[model samples]
Target chain A: MARATGCLAVSLGTALQICLLFGTASLLSVGGGNSVVPEIQLRAVDTYHWLSAAQFGDLFAIAQAAPGPSMLLVTLVGYKAGGVVGALLATVAMILPAGVIVHVVARFWQSSSGARWHVAMERGLAPVAIGLVAASGAIIARTTEHSPAQLALTAAATLVLCATKLNPLFLVAAAGIAGWLGLV
Target chain B: MSRDRPSSDVSLGRLAATFCQIALASFGGGLSAWSRKVVVEDRGWMTDEEFLSAMTLCRVLPGANQVNLAIYVGSKLRGPRGAVAAVLGLIAVPVLIVLVLGYLYFRNGSVPATQSILRGITAVAVAMTFAMAYKTGAKALRSLPAWVLCAASFLLSAVFRVPLPVMLAIVAPVALWWAWPARPDASP
Candidate 1:
């Protein structure tokens, strides 16, 4: 009976630890989910010893490929630490604080709509935002593209998407087939 | 081109389903593009200008850009409950999928051989992002100062790899100054 109680306590403690680690990471991830990847890796792999480095790498691949936000990486990490419950806790911790901040800001933005400063903000920020979007593309290209063929695919897709109103899903599907066939 | 604006009275279920579709459709990457398509183009929930600015605000703030976006759009449309619904829709299915993948990886001791397919998809994903940039830029980059600010932001972010906060610190002030609305009484 005592052992059982001790085990329960340890699991609860582990869950709490998951919350704390991910909660802090949630606030620190200013540049999006990828910003905190290294921090997560260092803590989870090096400090906590929850999983091997290889496992972390694989999870990252899985997260990127599985769809949705890659920040779901936290879910996997939490799963490793505490199973289903840990995963839920980690996810909530990761999103709640940051989500709250964005929500408040969104409300404020809405309330200030059509004001002169708001107009200034909308215009001034639009250019910078578009720039960041393009920068993300450049960064992703540098990291993901290896061969000239892949580069050509990206370039061609960009041109097609820009000039035409073609749905991008078709291009993405074709690229996948090319990859599966080892064409690119 | 700003057009008819959709009402924010979107039902919670619709918000959830819409975000769910957006999340699932972003297979390789470019979740942001998928978001813009659904939120601005298909649904008409927001104009290009509103969406662009909201996106930057989300990026500048903490957390995952997609999740933050989900929160922003959801809250705008339906308040706190809407935000919850959107986030759940966006992540619930994907989280389960990722968990399954994690299980398989841990069990089988290796990722399944989807590397090549992912490679191709990743390339397209990059393209999707570039396309998003081009599409939005055509509308936003109308002025020389706007072009300069966009270029500076792009260079700082892509080439110098300046951190976002620092880049924003350097560029935002100039952008705000240039874009500040002229006093109605004083300026032409």
Candidate 2:
């Protein structure tokens, strides 16, 4: 019983920590969830020891597979730590701050126009967002690339995606097959 | 800008419902297409040109593209309150579903069927992301300089493994220099 209580407390604490980290990250994630991968990997694998490196990769896969934002990995990690309550807590924590900020910003943005700083900031942020997106693609490729077949698939997919009008879902399906077949 | 323009005939409730439908239907991450289908094709809420303009604005704004989309659609249909209602409705169901699923998933790490489905979904998602990147890049890369910047950014990050923020610091100033409005007499 004491052990159970101790575990519960630990889980709750972990959930809270996850929320704070993710909340801050969410606000800063102007480029999207992929941009936060480096930080997430560092915390989840290096700092927390909640999961091994391979497990983090699996969680990332699960997050991408699921709908909504990729930042949903926070809920997955919280769930692993504590369960439903933890998941709920973590999700709220991660989403609420950014939601509120966006809401407020949208409201204000509607009325205000021709603000110099606002224009400057938007102009300044665009290239940063572009760079971050590229970095994120690279990071995902680095982690997911494991073998000759996987590398080939990744290159082919990237090239096809950049060059052709073919639907991306086909490539993903091919990659999954490769993964299942131990080709990657 | 007409601040006193009357609201569209679409009721707030209907607007909210439309947003919810979009959220639920966005199983894969092709939200831009899904949004286009719903807002422009199905509902006739906005014209294609209007939808595209709003999408551009949303992309430049901070926040999830979908959330920004809800805001734009809602604001167009009604006003500020409509925007709030639409965004809330869009997120409410997804959050609830994710919370419940998170509970089950945490309690039990992975079930075989679920794992298989997720694996399939992951592949689809990767494809969807690539498609989005390609589409967006085509629109954004209008000039040779812009294309060069894109290539430089990609190569720097992918090959050199430079941190994202650092790369941003390097590329942003260059983009600014290129995008900065020219003086009247400075034109060639």
Q: Is the docking of candidate 2 incorrect, acceptable, medium or high quality?
A: incorrect
TM-score per prediction, in order, is 0.94, 0.61
Local accuracy of candidate 2 as per-residue lDDT tens digits, B1-188: 11222447777887788787776655534455556556755677764434543554554444555676777677656666777788767766766655556444445775234444343333344444444455555555656776777777777777887665576677767866675545422311
Candidate 1 lDDT for residue B163? 93
Scored by DockQ, the top model is: 1
lDDT of 2 by residue, A52-121 (tens): 6775676665665555555667766665555555556666666556656555565565444345433433
Candidate 2 runs further than 4 Å off: A1-61, A77-85, A104-184, B1-93, B114-121, B183-188
Give the C-alpha lDDT of model 1: 0.88
Give lDDT per model, in order. 0.88, 0.58
Q: In candidate 1, how many Å is residue A46 off?
A: 2.3
